[model samples]
Target: MQKKYVTIASFTAALEPGILEETERYLAIIILLAGFKRYRSWRVPIAIYGSALLFGLSHLGNVGWNGETFEATIAQVIGVMGSGFLWAVLYLYSGKLWIPMIFHFLMDYLANLQSGWNSAGWQFNGWATDYISEVLMVLVPLIVTIWMMYGKRREVLEENADRLMNLPVEFNRY
Candidate 1:
């Protein structure tokens, strides 16, 4: 099984380095643009938590296909959700996309070591089907949406999301 998995995943090994470097380059720009204030916003964290929870339920197909207990799968989902939350916090507080991106990479890599792929996060256990492989082909960052939604809250993010959205960029619209 490991051999097959390696053989299949090997196609991307050559491209990994280049992809990682390019990802870092873009992340740097994103982080700079995100600024520091957005990090303070709690809405960003809420959205992150939301996405993590929803991502797990989106795995109905895997639970059906693998004959795995929904409870067991949910446990994994919970773990992934936790991991996602951690990544979210790292990004929001650091205002650095690369920070979470690297953490994400390490996570997927280590998970691959454990039991192939699973739908808990961004995929359906690789051993379950080719479907999981395809899902992971694309990576999306939902944290930015949180930042965009909440805008800047330099004063306090604990509850300024609604306030931020209403205020103008220059405080002129108000």
Candidate 2:
């Protein structure tokens, strides 16, 4: 049985404000590099994906945290990346932080139930099968997210282009 404290902590971590910290950090970087004028139009997707990747990579420390081997860490990292992307996309699509927060909580709850604290390697018996499952966990959501995001991104770009083209000449004075 999973420890109640661990489970609760894990679930809480999933919904923690720190989850969105990367987005904030990345947004600051994007603003510094691209400025607010380009932030919505060009930097949004970049910040989304970039922060997701960084969020995923940050969890690589879980190897040490969980005392897992490097190989297992790699597998888990792939899955983490997928989860990060899925949550980020959800936030972007819904324009609501709560949506992603709930999903993240569920994911972390499930993960903790399966892996337990410091039981990363022991959670699975067959190493190869575990690795495959981990990879799939990442790939399935990532592929679907990319497909959905692509369509939405195109729509946003087209809308922006039309709005820009239709703007009055005097609007450029700013």
Candidate 3:
């Protein structure tokens, strides 16, 4: 006897969560910006860091839900912040939410496939390389995000600050 598997179904199931997560996080950024409207110069920084930190903290609940180890969960939270920051910056830089949504979806989908949707109770074996990889995971995206938001690329966010923040007028003067 042979068994059939529905790979497309698994991929489709993975898609919804990524889109919803990114949408919610980005909306939170916009809301943060709106709330800080009076502090025009600090709005972008607050929105990006605030939303990204919230996104990372959200993963903490996964430790309880998925039985993930505390240490592993801590690493995941830190790593996810980098990813969240990168996504947020990508949205700002491209002036398109879909860019980050697609990246987020693809990343989640691939991870799901790699782990076969059975990531519960995963742990680090304490290899030196494991620690190095964990650090790199967090640092690389953070470095990239910082680079993307500075120098020439900063102009992109400045040009679309109003649109990205959902504000009525330009707020990037600061």
Candidate 4:
């Protein structure tokens, strides 16, 4: 989806500082104003849950090789799942999925960059060689996403014409 790509691209840029939760809320306001508030509905939970589930499943195959204990695997999976919810909220509140997307990208990218990531083969980043390059990649999308959704205007009628025209005056009795 275009939005998903954009989300990935935005987060890939890595421009945002740490205040991720606050950023998401601000972004949500923009989408609400832009009249895309419908995406803010169940979409948030769905996307997050889906992403987390997939992430956990991906780790399942690696359990034996990675030597993770059963308890550790469950806990890790749950943490990853929670990340999905957090990211969804971030996307919803910020009205800019870019940051979360880029953040997500960074997370995935870093994971791939680790020594064992390439062995997994299915999820590997050929272009992101170093931490610096990966970080820059993450930052680009974050900036662009924010810039695109920076500000929008609405034609708001400040005063009602009828109310202005209906002013009445009375003579005071002395």
Query: Which candidate gets the maximum lDDT versus the true structure?
Result: 3
Q: What are the per-residue Cα lDDT tens digits for candidate 1 across 1-174?
A: 354445335434323422453254334323433443354433344444554455444444445444566644554554454455455445545555567666666555555545554323333354644344333321233443345344343223333332334433333211
Q: Write the per-residue lDDT of candidate 3 for residues 1-174, one digit (tens) a residue.
A: 112223776577567757877898878888887898788667766777788888888877768546677887877777778888888888777878888889887876676676655323445667897689878877888788667656567666655667765556543346
- Model 1's number of clashes is 6
Candidate 4: tens digits of C-alpha lDDT, residues 83-104: 5445544554454556666776
How displaced is residue 88 in candidate 1, in Å? 1.1
Number of the predicted model whose TM-score against the real structure is largest = 3
Over 76-162, each residue of candidate 2 has an lDDT whose tens digit, in order, gives 667667777777666555545567666666665565665554324424445688878887888888786668545555454334323
- How high is the lDDT of residue 108 in model 1? 59
Candidate 4's error at 92, in angstroms? 3.7
Count of steric clashes across candidates, in order: 6, 0, 0, 23
Q: Each model's TM-score?
A: 0.44, 0.63, 0.82, 0.33
Q: Which portions of model 4 show Cα errors greater than 4 Å? A: 1-43, 95-97, 105-174
lDDT of each structure? 0.44, 0.55, 0.72, 0.39
Single out the weakest 10-residue window by summed lDDT for candidate 2: 165-174
Clashing pairs in 3: none
